[model samples]
Target: MSGIILLLQFIAAVIMLPLHILNFLGFWDAIIKKLFPLFYNKLCETYNKSMDEHKRGIFSNISDFSGPSKELRLLEVGCGTGANFKFYPSGCKVTCLDINPNFQKFLSKSQAKNDHLIYERFLLASVDNMTSVADGSMDVVVCTLLACSVPNIPAILKEIQRVLRPGGAFYFIEHVASTDESSWTGFFQKVLNPSWSLIFDRCSLRKTTWKDLENAKFSELNLRHITAPTSVKLIGPHIIGYAVK
Candidate 1:
């Protein structure tokens, strides 16, 4: 009887391991989502000047402020907690998309706070397959710190291109692989990638995202690399720019 009880206990432990792991990942992700807004807001305070410099003319040709509907449309891909809402020009209808449903609550909070911006919709979908959004619909598509986690960067860029009207812009700020992969920083990023992905939901530290974006179907691409704050050495070097369709 004791042997049978022990056997059952071991079986239960085996069965619970994966479930526990999933739960932990969910819990960690939720905590990050909740705390990220505060962190990001502070980061912006410190880096706003640089960020604004990079984002110059990103909203050029987008017009109509003051609650006017259907004039200017902006779509944010992987808009975690809607952190970018404050940067948008007022009265533009904004659509947000994310794979993590957990961020919906945060996005709602952000939308409520930024009442000047009109909320079009929130779609719980990956950027690679945003079929729910009509083609050639958005005037601007924005992404920040997003491409690292996507499984197919090129596919997402293609989808962005497809959804953008001619002369529309896709603005992005992403951490990319080191310029020289043989550098010590690159070696560290490679070694730390597995653990980083496990903690941060598959965010790769060594993705050659800038090169991929350059190769995407864009009429013109302008990009520049900037050194991020030293605190984020794990994902520090960043590329910021826009690609025009």
Candidate 2:
């Protein structure tokens, strides 16, 4: 079985080599920026529809604002097309952040549609390095489908810990690497990772993001792993939870 899997992976890698070369030549960068928002927004809709129950359970904490004021100050890292805005509770003052500036227009459309929550300024910056946001300023920090792509997961988590208020919560929903190496899914993730990253804005299919969250040492953590209901089998494995700082 192992030998067969390896052979299949090798053949798949060979088939993907040309696309990888195009990615290396920056052929996909401009195209991705132009199309990714639309693609991601559609994916978000599918996930939201399929995983509504799980998402509601995980995001329930955001509604429990124990702050002195009624309004909750929220920051979303990698806030692609503002897909999560609909899930946010009312009276939330949301500040969006993303590496891609192209998403701003789509994000604006999403914001306009979800008018229940207040929209703060959107910052064009990377999640790993958010120097503009002050320490202990955010009441809640949310990230979804982002951990897989970041260049440095630890750095991004560290910055998340830094920006959250003492008791503020960090909520996340991320697809992760399959844990079972003997499984075909895991084998494919390993073999296709290089091309996957090149084509998808450096998003790795093999990151164990849950482990990084565990190592971050949040005061309280509640995490669960599940399979996302998506046709893309490679990205089905996911982790969803929150960590209180």
Candidate 3:
């Protein structure tokens, strides 16, 4: 089994060598920026159906704010293509943030499609360092399908906590590593992780992101694991829930 795994990894590495070179040259980022949204949108169509109930339950809290005069402030870190815009409660003043400026055009189109929510602005910033956003300013913080790709999960979570107001919620949905290492999916994830990350913008299939969330010291944490509805078996394991600050 070990020998077979080594052979698979070697073959995958050789196959992905060109992509690694393109990534190192910074050309892959440009290509992914243009193409990823289209691919992600199709993925979300199926993914959203599977998580509709969970998303509705999580986003329901947005309507709990009292008074009609107060504006509901929301910040979505790594808000690629504004995929969660439809799930948001009406009248939300949403600030979208992403490290890639190329996503702005796609996000704008999504914002237009979901006209009920107020589009605040798009910030081209890394999730780990969001110094531009004021401390404790957001009523809610959201992230979906993003934690896998970030260089530092803990740093990003810290920033999410920092920018949220007292009693504010941080909602997240992230694919995680399979706990059962004996499983074939887990074996492939471990074997192909290096090549996969190289091809897909540093998205690690083996990150135990749920563990990081637990250690983040949120006042209240409500989390659950689920199998994401995707044909890709490597990213099937997922954690979906929210934590309150």
Candidate 4:
């Protein structure tokens, strides 16, 4: 029994040795972050019009939003490379929070390109612990393609709820686990999840995003499932909606 356990441990170590080396070198994370924006930005460029329309529908209901007198205070969690900068209303104050500081350069570029948005501040913090931001301060909180990768979804949602003012909007777009777990794409997602998570800064292939949002502390959740154009089976099915705090 002792020999068998030792042998199993040895095999596991052998299999994980290369992966450990890659992780240590930060090879996969660096490459994916560098290349992901190129393809994803193209997809966003094509689909942004529809997304913008949907976002507008959400904003239309909010009574006290950005106007000539007041600038809406917006917090964007995990604002990777600032892909959604263009979708924001002009002159709204935008605060960006992200775990990885490397994206700061890209964010600066995005801010420069989209002069309409007032880039307020950048916080280097995890989504789950946004203590730097005061409670009930933000009028709007936005997160895109973020839920699938967070370490603790519930904790992050809680933070979001805490920071948002009463009746503030929490806009989110996230990839989620499929209802039919046995489907081809689902199967691939399950198979690739471990490797994918290891490579991409703990981004999970499976997430019950809709259910998670429903279970959150939000007063209202208006979410819709949609098939994203990205052919990647791991993250093809997406949800877009807003929760009222």
Cα RMSDs, all models: 9.2, 2.0, 2.0, 5.5
Error of 3 at 51 (Å): 2.7
Clashing pairs in 2: none
Model 4 misplacement above 4 A: 1-17, 24-69
Model 1 score (lDDT): 0.76
Task: Report the CA-based lDDT of candidate 4 relative to the real structure.
Answer: 0.78
Q: How do the residues 1-245 of candidate 4 rate in per-residue lDDT, one tens digit apiece?
A: 44654565456556767876766786767766665656545655655654566656655544354434476899999987787887777778999999877677777888899999888899999999999999988989999878888878888999999998887889988888776876877766665666667655677878887888999988888898877666465677788888988
Candidate of highest lDDT: 2
lDDT of each: 0.76, 0.87, 0.86, 0.78
lDDT of 2 by residue, 95-159 (tens): 99998998888899999999999988899999989999999999999999998988789999999
Candidate 3 RMSD to the real structure: 2.0
Instruction: Tell me the spans in candidate 2 whose CA falls farther than 4 Å from its real position.
Output: 1-10
CA lDDT of 184 in candidate 4?
73
Report the lDDT tens digits of candidate 1 across residue range 14-62: 5556644765677766665555556555555555555565555444434
Residue 64 Cα positional deviation in candidate 3, in Å, after optimal superposition: 2.9
Per-prediction TM-score to the true structure, in the order listed? 0.76, 0.92, 0.92, 0.80
Worst 10 residues of 4 by lDDT: 60-69
Off by over 4 Å in 3: 1-3, 24-26, 65-70
Residue 222 alpha-carbon offset, candidate 2, angstroms? 0.7
